[model samples]
Target: MPAAALKPKPSNEPLPTQSTAKRPVPLDTPYAPVAKRPLPPGRPREWYVTHNRRLKAMRLAIALLDSGVHQPDQARDETIRSAARLIGVHPPSETTCHMVRALMRYAR
Candidate 1:
């Protein structure tokens, strides 16, 4: 008998093809955190106590300055006093106020 007549026919099933493209993956290295925890819902604690007082004091001082109640050039001590009063802190001296103003300018 011949070799062709002794073998069965192969089936017409499809063969699986593999992809050659590289897939992207996220880096697994650890990184330092940059975000802070979000504040809780509702009014913040600082708002009622610190922030409110500070804003009121600043507004009072600015109003006084703008209304010509005190001269800006000579009222550094007064401004600091008014701010301290609004915030319920001890009134700072003229020198302290000058330092505060200079520090504030530098901070910005």
Candidate 2:
């Protein structure tokens, strides 16, 4: 019978990792300008004027709500034009700008 032999224990040191040995590549080389979809042609003057009006109206509505005016009392669905008028914004509404009211009602 062969004599009983004592085997050595496994090493406690961490195994060599690939990330530490690999060289990193540089990413800042100048490349051809990426093809981007061209922006839509400029809009008519009337379009710009209307867009500005909508923005103004929306802002006015937000301000009115912030000011705590007509808290859930008056008709909240009033057009942006009307709300804008109430909040002193002018030349309102190419389209009927219904108020996009942001009410935060906490659940009971």
Cα lDDT computed for each candidate against the true fold: 0.51, 0.46
- Stretches of candidate 1 off by over 4 Å are 1-75
Q: What's model 1's TM-score?
A: 0.30
What are the per-model C-alpha RMSD values against the true structure? 23.9, 18.3
Using all chains and alpha carbons, the TM-scores for the candidates as numbered come to 0.30, 0.32
Worst 10 residues of 2 by lDDT: 99-108
For model 1, what is the alpha-carbon lDDT of residue 32?
Answer: 32
* 46-82 per-residue lDDT for model 2 (tens digits): 8866665555545655554544554433325454345
lDDT of 1 by residue, 4-53 (tens): 99899875543456342343433333223335555455887865555445
* Model 1: how far residue 107 lies from native, Å: 2.0
Q: What residue runs in model 2 are displaced by over 4 Å at the alpha carbon?
A: 1-41, 69-87, 91-108
Q: Return the clash pairs for model 1, or none.
A: none
